[model samples]
Target: MTEPLGAYGSVVEMLEAAATRAPDHPALVCEQVELTYARYRDCVAALAADLARDGIGAGDRVGLLMGNSAQIAVATFGVQAAGAQVVPLNPAYTESELGPVLKDADLALLIHDAGLEELAGAAAPKGTRCLIVGPGARDLTQPTGAPPAPLSLPDPQTLSTLQYTGGTTGAAKGVDLRHAAVAVNVAQREALLPTGPDERVLAITPLFHVYAVAMGLYLAANCGGTLHIVPKFTAAAVLRDIERHRITFLSASPTIFQALLRDPAFAETDLSSLRVCSSGSSALSAEVLHRWEEATGCAICEGYGQTEAGPVLTYNALHGPRRAGTVGVPVPATEIEIVDTDTGLVPLAPGAAGEIRARGPQLMAGYRNRPEETAATLRDGWLYTGDIGRMDDAGHLVICDRKKDMVVTAGYNVFPREIEEVLFAMPGVADAAVVGVADDYRGEMLCAFVVGAEGDLPEERIRAHLAERLAKYKWPRDIRCLAALPKTAVGKTDKKELRQVASVPPSEPA
Candidate 1:
């Protein structure tokens, strides 16, 4: 019987327990490198020692700015092992883009990749200790097999991570995750992924994000499973590696699933070992979900959560029935409450749109250093998950739209998702993001940024296409065809950023 991990003190305790039980097992794999439990254990210890030498101790925030690599894994574990909270910065963040996170977080040390050294130099604090961890990075990847250098770390209840929620809100703030909270979230994620000691899982998603950490590292740690970490996400490379490693599980967003399904060699690839797939970060379109399940002959489960909640609120298990668009029932030990904006959680009889409210042990400590924002978000012990969704008779939660993302035309409420669903049903539209832009006539006009099939799909053609299925008001007045939509860290269309760039002052009329 698997002994459930109730309250492991820290990452050090978690890794040590996993290692002591299975030292000979391979703990991690990233292109051309395989690290056993014992080797990985020593690596964590040495890396922790190095961190303590550089003045990073318990609860201190260090930025992890790098792509998906074995070193990235080692660095994350190493930072936690040294008793510091790691703020995983998105590699795409420019000096200006990264400014908010750097300013928001009380960070002193930055372990950035050499590729980002210039940006790091520009973004680093006045007296920040920034270390490069890439090709020319001085931090050695090879383990020296040293003991952990000691520090006066607080109790395990102290914050271990400061995950920044994706944009929509103007200035991003950190979600403080306590040791107890993370353990609950990790255990919930591990419960859903059917893996074992010998089995290997693909880590194609960005490890900087919460979803990847929950699935790739934490889940793998619990089962003592091997993590096949790809450097970055590329459909062709992912397919090749899946066959090469006999990968048992693939965790990713729907965009990745669609890309994989489109690959010509997808059929010929040796996908015999694939056990199941789990998708989140965005809604998985119903059509694509069915297509992948049809093609691969594997179960694809839907999981949903946010960075503020240690990232797992609900997940689909293998035993339950897989609904088409639902994000499954509440994860074990997680609770759900749907409420109206004006009032508290009023249980809708059935099939009613309301804001999703969740309160559980897996919840984060609070937003780091932003007490007012934290107080507003984490109120009365429940997270007012700004997402609008409903519970069905069967208990599955179906998210309709973000509370802010829902478009309002005049006095009537028009959910962008309602229109996007109709657009996705159309043959040519690949993906879509609908937002309300300013208009002189209507209060706000619905505008769409769409990615069409590989061809010249004109705005009029798209308008004509949606006109058949949508109401006149909901039909997007401005339809912009995109090569690919800009994505937030969690893989959803970065609509807020898109709106910002779209609304940039018209160059002062040049």
Candidate 2:
């Protein structure tokens, strides 16, 4: 493990270097436009100056609500350079969800694109300084205005971002990532992957997601790597874009890999240029990993992180003893402990499966505005990640289950991913939820709400498919099928809504 960079250097060093060394190189790509590094740095400097002019400064929170684009990257860099804390919010967050967060974080500045203009404008704090980045927003591809008076950064430990987490167990809380922590994560990221100044990064993951916020934007910024930002991920489009840019680095989800692997054109793409393809946000199934490696000739290295620890805990190094199922050994400067789930203790044995807990320089200072919750989560300076996993003798980690009441149906943890993965395999199963509905048996009977796919993938056959894989105790006892399963943003099955529909007795055909 490399000694952490204690003598903090300026993040602007990265932007400034790209500006000088690779002035004409494409730094960020979206749609048809590409932003050069020189233009990107100048735009950041200008935007930083603009925010300072708007009364936003170091220690103030600046909210950004938009999809992935060159503007988001520039705005993020601008916020950091201007010495303001960046709060990246998901554009898809409902008004109800978005309201409390802005208030809690005490946001004074906001930037938004058109799709979210209606929701974001309505949510902006009154008298809050604001900037908009959209189709006609700030021609960010081109620098605007004079070089703003540069803002001096505080100590590296100063707050950098208040990123929102998934909040599966409770309301969303802001994870306070300090500049030192983010810098540590990025420095370690660069060490692990070792990219050159000339490499291009194809970033399709949403900028709002903390992984992208830290690893995608900040890491690339720290290394002077060119950023190719895709607003969203589509297999066909990403395939074309990768070849178009000769992209070398990719940060994305397992689903995107599955979609690409399923494509007949996947084999034809020049994915050979991509040296580092990383996946997080969900488990990259061994099956999907195998298929991806076969199709692209590049292995999917699983990196692990959460919003609380400045978003990166462990990443399979580009060259090291990279494990397939485990999230890999702890990163260079991080310490992770997998302990007994219920006992709240670390077991002596190497193969024990337990809750994953970690502490490091990258750890968040704390959650914003939630003391009790913060105390409950951050125990003894260690963030108790709710993920269940086991550590091998080699010190690798393998995720087993979630501590919360949830189901991981086929890699998409059905936080409500549904009773599907559990119930799908039961004997006599049509379909099932294994959900709780004031059940008389076992307090919560494993009920299966199943349906037969019409032509080939029928319910019984699906049950058979599952029976061979899952343990019998985990199988659903009761099965029923509706026309469809409910879903939330990003398309995970809505089990809470399904519980309501399950109350009605299954109808029988005459």
The CA lDDT at 365 in model 1 is: 84
Candidate 2 wrongly placed segments (more than 4 Å): 1-13, 20-24, 125-129, 149-151, 406-510
lDDT of 1 by residue, 1-510 (tens): 133645565555667777888989888888777888877777777877888888788758888888888888888888887778888887765464477678788686888788887777787667777878666555445766545443233357877888876434434567889877887677766665556777688888778888888877777776777889989778899999999889988887776787788888898898888888888776777887888888888888998888888888887776767788899888877888788866655756558888888988888888777788778778899998888899888888898877656554432235676567667777887887787765433445677778888754787778887775544656776776777888989988887876764554335421
For model 1, give the 10-residue run with minimal summed lDDT: 145-154
Best by lDDT: 1
Candidate 2 local lDDT, 9-84, one digit each (tens): 4455556655666778767767776677766777788877777778788779889887888788888878888888
Cα-based TM-score, every candidate: 0.79, 0.79
Root-mean-square deviation of Cα positions for candidate 1 versus the true structure, in angstroms: 10.8
Q: For residue 85, give model 1's deviation from the true position in Å.
A: 0.8
Model 2, residue 58: C-alpha shift (Å): 2.2
Off by over 4 Å in 1: 5-7, 145-154, 406-510
